[model samples]
Target: MSATRPGSVTFVAVLVYINGVLNIIGGVVILFTRDQMVRASNAGAIAGITTAAILSIVLGIVILIVARGLLSGSRLARGLVTVVMILNAVSGVILLFNFQFFSGILEILWAVVVMYLLFTQRANAFFASRA
Candidate 1:
C-alpha cells in the first residue's frame, strides 16, 4: 500500500477489527448473563433483549469480515463499512437521549473518524486501484 493509503485505510481497518472484537465479547457476555436481565423484565422483554444480543454478535462478525476485505482494498468493504458507521451513529444518537451521553458521544466520534478515513482521497484511490 502507498504511504498515504496506509495511514487512513489501515487505521480504519484496525479500528473496525478492534470494534468488532469488543462487540462480540460484549454480546457474548450479555447472552450469558441474560437470565439476570430476564428476571427483572417481562417475558416479551426477554425475547427482545436476547434478539438484540444475537444481532450484536451477528453484526460483529460481519464487521470482522468487512475488515478483512478492507485490508484487500475492496470497494465493497468500504460501502459496507459506511453503512455500518451510519447505523452506529444513529444508534449513538438514541443512546444520547437515554442519558448515556459519554458512551454515546464516544461511539459517534469513533464512527465519524472511521467514516472520514474511509472516504479520504487516499483510501478512495487505494480501493480504486485494487479494483
Candidate 2:
C-alpha cells in the first residue's frame, strides 16, 4: 500500500466490499424466498423473481471486483465508484417524489458526504501519489 493512501479511500473500499456482500445476499434471498412471495405460483412472477435475483447477484459480483480495485488504488475503480454514487444520489431524488422523504434525504446526504470524503485535499494527494 502507498504510504500516502487516504483513510477515506480505505473506508470507501470497505464500504464497497460490504455493499457487494449485501447485494449478493439479497439476490440469493430473492431466489430462495421467491416461492413465498404473493402470486409466486404464476409463471410470470417466478420469471420476474429469477431475473431480479440473477441481476442482483451479477451486480454484487461486479461491485466486489470494484472494491478490490479500489483497495489497489486503481483510478478506474475510483471512476466506477464515482459513477455508482452519482446514480445512487439520483435515485434518492426519485425516491423523494415517491413519498419516501426521509430515505430520499438520507441517500442524497450519504452521497454528498461520500464524494466529499473521496475528493478531499488529502485524498487527492494520496491518489495522485499513487499515480
lDDT of each residue in 1-131, candidate 1, tens digit only: 44345688888889889989988998999888888986765888878878888999998998899989899888899999898889989999999999999989988997898899888877778888886
Q: Could you tell me the lDDT of residue 56 within candidate 2?
A: 95
**Reference-based lDDT, each prediction:** 0.86, 0.87
Stretches > 4 Å off in candidate 1 = 1-5, 86-112
Candidate 2 residues lying further than 4 Å off, grouped into runs, are: 1-3, 38-40, 97-99
TM-score, each model?
0.73, 0.87
- lDDT top scorer: 2
lDDT, residue 6, candidate 2: 81
* Predicted structure 1: clash tally: 0
lDDT of 1: 0.86
Tens digit of lDDT per residue, candidate 2, span 14-116? 9999999999999999999998885756989899989999999999999999999887877788888888789989999999999999999999998888888
